[model samples]
Target: MTSIALITGASGGIGRGLARQLSAQGLRVAAVGRDVDRLADVEATLRIVADTTTPEGAALALETCVRELGAAPTQLAHCVGTTLIAPLHRTRPDVYRELIRVNLDSAVYMLQAWLAALKGAPGSAVFASSVVARIGVANHEAIAAAKGGVEALVRSAAATYAAQGVRINAVAPGMTETPMTAGLLNLPAVREGAGRQYPLGGVQTADQVADVLNWLLGDGASRLTGQIIAVDGGFTTVRPLVK
Candidate 1:
């Protein structure tokens, strides 16, 4: 059977990549995002314009997707997130709130709506996390805390839905070059320094992370659930040799 996938944040980097890749794999893709213009460019079976950060918006997104596709989506790729770089003290309450809304709240709302749409049918969901959620990273307090919540949500939701054959997982990436990171990566010195922090000595691209997300949603990952797969170029695990 051909898989139907609903992808939130489908106008942006990783989400767009997933839409293209999944479409190539013959899945009927429903691309959802806030920007109609950008989402129009995404290759998918249906393009939905919705915020997806609020419960109403998430529900509308799923409803519209199903209405257009003629069936509920069995696969989901939630690529909605933000990259906030700031120390706890330096981070404003508004900034922290936005981070939570974009990263954590969006994931929660989307997953809830996705699960409801599935209605006991087996499905798979892959959302984005951050390497900072796994380890302490300076000047990343806000994003880390929000994504930590995301990591926790994935595990809890996975366990709750496992008996029904529903799978949930996340990919934690480090220093990927996307529009969200454009400000930080535009500077030569900053970009180089960011790259060096990874033992593999380069940042990930949106497509690279999208590949992993795609695999986790496929039957190849039938046994994988509630796992936070790190695609951070060994940034979280490897200790480089001291020169």
Candidate 2:
């Protein structure tokens, strides 16, 4: 049977790549995001405009996908997130709250709505985490804390719903080149320096990360649950050799 997938943040980098890749593989894709026109060219079975950070919006996104696509989406990719490069002291209250809303809150709200939509049926969910959430990275206190919550949410939800046939996992990637990150990577010097930080020797691409997210949602990952897969080019695991 063709799998029905609900991809949130479908207009963004990794989410867009996943949507196109899954659709190309013959899966039915319901690409959803807050911007209607942005999600227009995401290459999916359908495009949905919905803000999934709120409970109401998340419910609407899932319900609309089910009602419009004619089935409960057995696969989900929650890619809705933002980045912040700042120290905890410099991070303002409003910035932290917004960070939580974008990164953590969306994960909680969307996962809740998706599981409820499944109604005891087996399903898979892959959320986006970051390498900073695992290892220490300076000036990354905000993102680290936010995505850390996402990591915890994935593991806890996986445990809670395992008996119910729900598989919850997350991918923690390192410095990736996306529109949302262009400000940090657009300069030639900064880009080279950023790439050098990875032991694997380069930054990541949207498609590269999407590939893992795709696998987690597939049958091959049948036993993989509650695990945070690091797709960070060994940034969190290995240190580069000295000259």
Candidate 3:
């Protein structure tokens, strides 16, 4: 039987890249997202349009995967997240709450809803974490906090599910070229400054991150779990020059 992968937020950006990559690797892809039209464009073996931001939506998405794909997914990729980049004091309560719900709660709900399936099938769950989860950045209070929770969630789930033949891991990316980073890249100075900060002197691509994720979900990374792999083009390890 062909392996199956359920990728949340699969309508765009990194999520879409992962969907395409996994599908190309002969895995059945269940593309999940709130945007039905966009999700339909993913060209996957299956498509599930459910807003992962809500509990009901998450359940429905998993149900679709089980019904159409013939089993629980052999790989789960939780890529549903949002960011509100603003200083703590300037950030509104609603923004923080929404960020937490989208970035942290969605992953929790998806995992809970699919845990039995995952255990029965024995697969990998990969969360798309951010480098900001580890490093502090200006005007990123809400997003950073939510992503930190994601890192904690990955480690906790990995430990909890290891005995069940499941592996949980996260990929922390930095300055990737995606629609999410378009605004920052639009500004010439911001783009150049961001690039210079990376030791590789360039930004990472969504495809590069997708490649790592594909490997993690495959047997090549069978022994890996509870690890946060950085795909930041050396940004996480390099220190900025202080002049």
* Per-residue lDDT over 1-243 for candidate 2, one digit per residue giving the tens place of the 0 to 100 score: 678999999999999999999999999999999999898789999888888999999999999998988888999999999989988999999999999999999999999999999999999999999999999999999999999999999999999999999999999999887889888888989889988888988889999999999999999999999999999888899998867
lDDT of each: 0.92, 0.94, 0.87
lDDT of 3: 0.87
Task: Give per-model TM-scores.
Answer: 0.98, 0.98, 0.96
Task: Please give, for residues 76-97, the per-residue lDDT of candidate 3 as tens digits.
Answer: 9998887777899999898899
lDDT of 1 by residue, 1-243 (tens): 577999998988899899999999999999999989988889998999999889999999999988878888999999988787777999899888999999999999999999999999999999999999999999998999899999999999999999999999999998888888888889999999998888888778999999999999999999999999999989899976668
RMSD of 3: 1.5
Root-mean-square deviation of Cα positions for candidate 2 versus the true structure, in angstroms: 0.8
Better of 2 and 3 by TM-score: 2
Worst 10 residues of 1 by lDDT: 79-88
Q: Quote the lDDT for 238 in model 1.
A: 95
In model 3, pairs of residues that clash are: none
Instruction: Give me the runs in candidate 1 sitting further than 4 Å from their true place.
Output: none
Q: Candidate 2 — which residues are off by over 4 angstroms?
A: none
**RMSD to native for every prediction?**
0.9, 0.8, 1.5
lDDT of model number 1: 0.92
